[model samples]
Target: MTRIPDQPKRLRIVPISKLAAAPKWQLETLRALREPVFFWFTAGQGRITLGGSTRGVHPHNAIYIPPGTMYGFQAMTRTQGVALHMGDPTGLDLPETPLHLRLRDGSQHAEVAQIMDAIQRELEGAKDFAERAARHQIGLLAIWLERQRSSAGDDSPRGLSSTNANERLTARYSTLLERSFGSALNVGDYAQALGVTPTHLTRACRASCGRTALQLVQERRLYEARRLLSETDVPVQDIARNLGFSTPGYFSRAFSAHTGTAPSLYRKARGA
Candidate 1:
């Protein structure tokens, strides 16, 4: 299946060890993004914290993390892997949460690695229409993963087969927040929309994501604020209004409190 081209065409392939070379603060920060991440772990082992659950990852584990989920991973050993960062402005057919698949079969593992290599080559070769070629490769990878998920049947990954209440509620909350954050939705409003009490929502959020319900909502907003400040030419006041803040002052206070930088300063620093 061909991926629709309506979404932004940004593709990056990088090794996992780059994290070790990056600044300490960048590695320590948890990220919520508007893109899905595909990773193939070829060496080393570590744990992945995905929303409400943590899973150990080793060689041959492929992770498909959906947009809007909070995720972070660490490599305990000298890790090497291929990671694909894909933007999704059109709400493409990405997973709703994280999928950790262990390719116990050597052939399956090699096939995935080969596809990733192809994506990397297409990206680095810098040929004409390289972006188009990379997107096609990603679409193929997505289809292959879907096939594996279908064949897993009853013994699929716990993240897929299990329906833990806290996990379910937290996933729903994340999805809702991804769509409703700009509308000024609060914890109570979110809880009501999800048909649960604010207290229960907070409890579930903490149990699953290590964050309170209100914190999750605020964090999403702050992430958007930071993203806009770093990537767009929109005025600070305009961004504030669009993100549901009553005034630029309130937005600046919140942004500074959460991000330690005012909007204008962040934009300038990031060269937006």
Candidate 2:
């Protein structure tokens, strides 16, 4: 059966199969961009730096860097690989959270690299064969992601997935936060979905990120509230309800706890 192409405008998903397999990477050479680039080093290992500080990304590592993020890289060893460079036109806005994905040692590294390469080939040539190839490759990629989740043992931190587990978990949790932060007030719920216990999840969250899982959830909700108050004519009561608050007074109190000023005053100060 012929399948619809998975190409998104402004989001180029290139599989390495079509591109020159071995493109040399040089740290001394700088490549600046006016757009964000999401590169997946599926096969080779490399290290990156920003403003002289050593940045870390290796094989099976993928990165979503915003335009002008000021970064560079050096290959740790000689290797050939594929990369996907997604320019920021698709409005697939990356979250304000971390975008770096580092694969764990001894994870299904080769399989992940193969998945990326297959996607690149499909993207490069989307003919009937390529379409099927892309679909198959995407499934493999999902399987690798799943394996990461299942491998996080009892000793593993809550968000730890073996194959870029922490990063994948964070991305999933970030999506959940955006969708139901106001309503889902329990970290355990998020942990359950991520195949982790609440405590481990929180620790993984704090280690991979400087903030607690609860903090991220609350921050996202609060930021939404602030945006609504400042950008629209929504009343405080309605806004509170929209944010899953039972009462305007409660929302106001919570908002005030996080920010020194109450929601109404903060909105007014911003002339909203």
Candidate 1: tens digits of C-alpha lDDT, residues 1-272 = 12112224466887888754664334433455667888888898887756555568888889887766666565445777877887653524555557778888888987898889888989899999987887888888888878777677575563355647997888778777767777777899999999999999999988875778888777666766666666567788877877778888999999888778888888999898
TM for candidate 2 is 0.44
Query: Candidate 2, residues 1-272: lDDT per residue as tens digits?
Result: 12212113243564433433333322322233344455566565556533212345555565555444434455545534545454442333343222445556654566666666667767777677775555565545445544554554655531222324554555456556555655835788888877888887777655544457777666655766776676666788877776677888989998999878998898999797
How far out, in Å, is residue 72 in model 2? 20
State every prediction's TM-score relative to the real structure: 0.79, 0.44
| Whole-model lDDT per candidate | 0.74, 0.56
* Candidate achieving the largest TM-score: 1
Please report, as a residue range, the 10-residue window in candidate 2 with the lowest summed lDDT.
Answer: 1-10
Cα lDDT over the full model 2: 0.56
Candidates in order: C-alpha RMSD to true structure: 5.2, 13.4
On a 0 to 1 TM-score scale, where does candidate 1 land against the true structure? Answer: 0.79
